[model samples]
Target: MSYADFARSIGLGGIAVDDPDKLGDAWGVALAADVPTVLDVRGDPEVPPIPPHATFDQIKSMTQAVLKGDPNAWHLLTEGIKTKARDILPSRR
Candidate 1:
């Protein structure tokens, strides 16, 4: 079950947000609730979470996993590369 559903089952307030733009609003609703709240924010599963200071071993392991025929190999690799690139490259904004 989704986190929101799980939270509701446990008697807490739950807010599920699938859109990135609605995250702030979700947080607002969650914070304003009388009961404890769970803000379930959905994001792209293909995009791996890259740490700010990723180690060489970590990159190697992820690459090996992707090369081992993980179902979402292409997306995992591409998104990882993009994430790394953004870290290395200067910000345009």
Candidate 2:
């Protein structure tokens, strides 16, 4: 199950937010909430972790993974883009 689903199953209020604005909203809700809560910001696992000394080949493989999403892979390029956008932009009111 998804992380958010797992959290909810344990009686914690949770949200899997895909939008920047919704993320802020979820945070607010969690803050006001008396019980445990979770706000899952989806990330692309297919994108290789970028270290300071990453090689060109490593970067290329990471790019390929993003472009060709495998079901076995944990993330998608589109999700990565959306997540990055969310992080960059201010949440909606």
Tell me how candidate 1 scores on lDDT.
Answer: 0.84
TM-score versus the correct structure, for each prediction: 0.57, 0.47
The residue-by-residue lDDT of candidate 2 on 1-93, one tens digit each, is 477888999999878886645666788888998888888876444543355566668756876765575764445555544555555587664
lDDT of 1 by residue, 19-82 (tens): 8567778999998999999998876777767788889998898799788988888888887887
Question: RMSD in angstroms, candidate 2?
Answer: 5.9
Off by over 4 Å in 2: 44-93
The C-alpha local distance difference test score for the whole of candidate 2 amounts to: 0.67
Spell out the clash pairs found in candidate 2.
none
- lDDT score at residue 87, model 1, on the 0-100 scale: 69
Model 1 CA deviation exceeding 4 Å by range: 46-48, 51-53, 80-93
In candidate 1, what residue range of length 10 has the lowest lDDT sum? 84-93
